[model samples]
Target: MRLVPIQSVKEGSILAKTIYDSEGRVLLKEGTELKDITISKIEYLNIYTIYINDKYSDAVIEDVIKPEIRQKAIKKVRDVFYNLEDYNKNQNNYQGQNLYKKSEKDFQSVQYVARELIEEILSRKNVMIGLVDLKSFDDYTYQHSVNVAVIALIIGMKMNFHKYELFDLCIGALLHDIGKVFLPNEILNKPGELTEEERKIVQEHPKNGYDYLKGSYDVSVPARIVALQHHERIGGQGYPEGREGERISILAKIVAVADVYDAMTSTRVYRKALSPNEALEYIMANGGTKFDYKVVQAFSKVVIPYPQGTMIRLSNGDIAVVTKVYSQMPLRPDVKIVYSEIGTEINSIMELAKENSIVINGLEYEVPEDN
Candidate 1:
């Protein structure tokens, strides 16, 4: 099954996944038959196009692809949450170092998933994909982990790292947050400002994660180091160890930059999500202090600061929606001129970077408007 935009959704098509709200309530369920009114109702389902059956191409709207992805993501989050919660309640419940061992084993599995995704993207294969919806904490966690791993892998590939090293980097990134399992759910899901003590606990997760992984047999040294050192700052202001520039491992520094960018741009309980461009701007400004400069530069090159489907305001008082991400100049993507300054439909696609006089001043919509 492939994705089709909601505007292109037809009456006989079936939904591939259950659409949910920020509160975890289901807005629409999978297998629901589409209607024009159904398409017009929901607001945040932008980016995704509907899927149709490949077999008949007409007899059925078999939504096999996205639904499976949604189910997998949901299951992954639920399983991790429960397992972590269980471990959190009993720190010494393990007879030996099983907690860390279990985490390592889990990492081994998820690392494979990360590698497969990277290979699929790199090969330009026609793989099924459902967009990462950032409407929930679980989505933020799972998707950010995957995104960081992909970004790091891409950078590693470009830097000419061997296959073994790239695989290790994938392992390092996927397990970077495995220590968050040790923190209390209240702190992990805290919606308000965290106290100094709470902030310290949050910061200690890296070392805690590393220690746990190190205790387990068969875990690579780089995996443990990455878990511990991903928070180290280049300018010596980061947490846990606060190691200076060269002291921090190169892999850790790379993951550190990718982690911060993905987290800041993703939606969380505390604040509304920053646009991808805004997150990149924040990263670029703090590169020398909070992150490695070269890593940040690499990320800027690979990640689309203005990903497709975002709405932007132009200097000419026109409003447009992003339609495609170009290989060059990620900050300036191709946009569809959806509305004029007065909110009239233009139905035209405009290449912003190629346009001679137009300039995008800002993004106005944090949440996408439903079709």
Candidate 2:
């Protein structure tokens, strides 16, 4: 299977993986053949890319969290947020108590999903995480929460965090942005520059999330701290509280790295998403100030800088598709040469770490047609 942009998807292409809607409903099932109307419907849903079966590029990118688990987790998180929204709308109603109970149940379900994700990651210590963000703008928050949880868990495992500790960290990561649920939809989704008052409200999400999580009888102190302190920077430049260095809880610090990484790599209302390599570079550059250095170090170990299925140009003028990523050498992954400078098919795989003379120049969206 090969990952292709929506524009490149043609009629009769087979979907290699199931695509889910905002509510976790399957929009298209695996092995479904694409028709003209189906492709248009996919574009209308704002999906940017998809995995399709193809003979030339059959390399499979493995996801640490399985699709079914991820979809269920997204639904659980969405339910919790929707419940919170409903409660906010009827703050004076007696149904508030029952809604809170339902929210708590949803939280428990999310935690269970988190544990499963941690187990999957732990089982495969050698696989570099190849999570691609295929979410639309409307589904960003739900997908992002799950992605952050997965990223944080991988980093936590690399740090040798115990299972219980990993559980708290993952829970915290999943709900770190819960405060945003309280913000007005206009303010949260506004595409233009925010006024100072709007900016302050946006920054208050950490404290708001912290307060919300603190009321839960089952949440741990460390998990609550993650909601409160994930935005606190090491250099005391962060928001809600300008906490610095060790003042931030270790769990919060770890989540901070995951939060920023996912946010940077995801397309928001105001900006385009950064490439995985670009996002990692940004994280590395701000390691000591904006993020905890050790956490960033751990993050570098698990994230695939150049994800598989991306077409890239080599410094030597060859065009290749990434086949696999080596955790130890992220910048130099295994690639299959799909075309040469003369626009001829080469069909050879190269382990870039061993190819000392080669360097990746930049990414290419599509290979140039053979001349």
Candidate 3:
């Protein structure tokens, strides 16, 4: 399967991955044929790209979590956000133990999902993640929460966090943006630049989320602070608390890097998603300044620059696809050469770490299928 822009997708092509709607419901299941009407429906939902089956690109794209697990995580996130939205909409007269019970239930369910994700990652012995899971723009926050949790878990695992610590980190990272539930859809999904006032309101989400979690939920202090201080920078230039250095807990610091990486790599309404290399470059550039250097190191260790099944161009002008990424040498992953410089078909696997001169130049999105 190959990820292609919506416009480039042909009508008769088949979908290689499942597509979810704004509410995390399955909109188009995998293996669904992309007819004219189906393609139009996808376009109407503001989904800019999708994975489609290609005869030439034999590489397979795998998500970090199982399909059921990812969907369940997304569903839980959606439920929590929706509950918060409902509470905000009805806080005036709605009073009972029910609210507290629901909040407790939500937090508990979230904890279960986090623990499940941790188990899955732990079972895979040093799992490396890919740049997948781009849902609709309207569902950005919900999907992003799950993705951030996964990324944060990978980083935590790299740092040798035990199961208990991973639980707090995972739960905190998942609900880091819960405060955004109070935001108006117009402001949250605004296509244009946010004004000064709007930006101020946007910056208040961390504090708001922290307050709600602290006051109503049964989460740990570390988890609560993650919502409050995940934006905190290493040099005291972050929002809500302006915390610096060790003032921020290690869990929050870890989530800080994870949050930025996911946000920058995601496709937002205002800008396009950055490539993996581009996002990593930004993170590495800001390491120890805008981000914690130690956490950034952990991030570099787990996130593969080119995940398995990603088509890339080598320095020698050959087109290749990534097979595996080494934790020690993430930049130089194992790749299978699929085409020669002159567009001739070739199939050879090369370990990039051993090949001194073969460098990965950039991502290759458009490879021939009927060449």
Candidate 4:
């Protein structure tokens, strides 16, 4: 079976998957055959339509339904953070071994954790407040660190970084914020503005994190350097030593771009969270001064500004939700929107191609209630 846009979907096509409502109501079950009115009415709904034959099965669902496993990995990382005291006693604090092993052992698990983290951060406006209820700040930190590592890894993957180097990059990115453990909770969670002294203290986290990892674990120099120099800027205005330009390691530069992008898109005490596109714009604007230009471009290619499952408003008096992203045109992907022009929910999906259709002039980060 082939996934086709609703516009070209012919009648007699079989339903490939079960259609569910926002309230979890099963609107249509698998094996349901399409009628002409059903297709036309659902076409107005601007939803995704899959053309299926007898051979199509639920194999796709199995691949997409692994959030439970991802959550398990997240819980394990959280445990490490929660039991940092034990970890430290066992000589495991800030050591890069944990980060490296987790990534090497389970790259998919790491990627899923990162994807969930990104969705949560983007959805919630207050980062610290949103994270506070997650039981352990340490786990939150670890999960976030892992998230950043995966982000860097994704960036590196796009740049064709070697597998070993990619693994090292993931390890370094995972441990990039480890020094925050030594920081005072008051300073870290301060809702108000931070003083220069407090800012300086915060800036020391990279160096401190690097020290903790280097001394505790037997990680490579690139991994250690990434933790230390991830904050160093291209214009020699970053933290610790402010080493300029090529003096910084490539891994450090890559992590820096991912780190700042995640931080900006994440909620902070002093400001509201920026949307993904907004944060990317900020990174691009300051590319040469605050970030590496090539890294920023790579990041832009890897991360979709409007990720899947996000709701968007169309010009045709309808609300559409992104269901999938197309590699060729990342911005214009497949969307599934609810419709009831005939007083019945014409549940289906739509593909927004740049070829010929109502142009999607606006985009949103929030998922719709009826998705």
Best by TM-score: 2
Candidate 3's displacement at residue 233, Å, is 0.4
Question: What TM-score would you give candidate 3 relative to the actual structure?
Answer: 0.90
**Cα deviation of 262 in candidate 1 (Å)?**
1.4
User: Candidate 2 on 199-246: residue-level lDDT in tens?
Assistant: 999999999998988888767889889989998999999988899999
> Residue 214 of candidate 1: its Cα lDDT?
77
Rank ordering of all candidates by lDDT, starting from the highest: 3, 2, 1, 4
The better-scoring model by TM-score among 1 and 4 is 1
Clashes of each: 4, 0, 0, 6
User: Which predicted model would earn the best lDDT?
Assistant: 3
By lDDT, is 2 or 4 better?
A: 2
Clashing pairs in 2: none
Q: Which pairs clash inside model 1?
A: 4-49, 4-50, 5-49, 43-370
Better of 1 and 4 by lDDT: 1
lDDT digits (tens) for residues 249-268 of candidate 1: 88888888778776776556
Give the clash count for model 1.
Answer: 4
> How many pairs of residues collide in model 2?
0
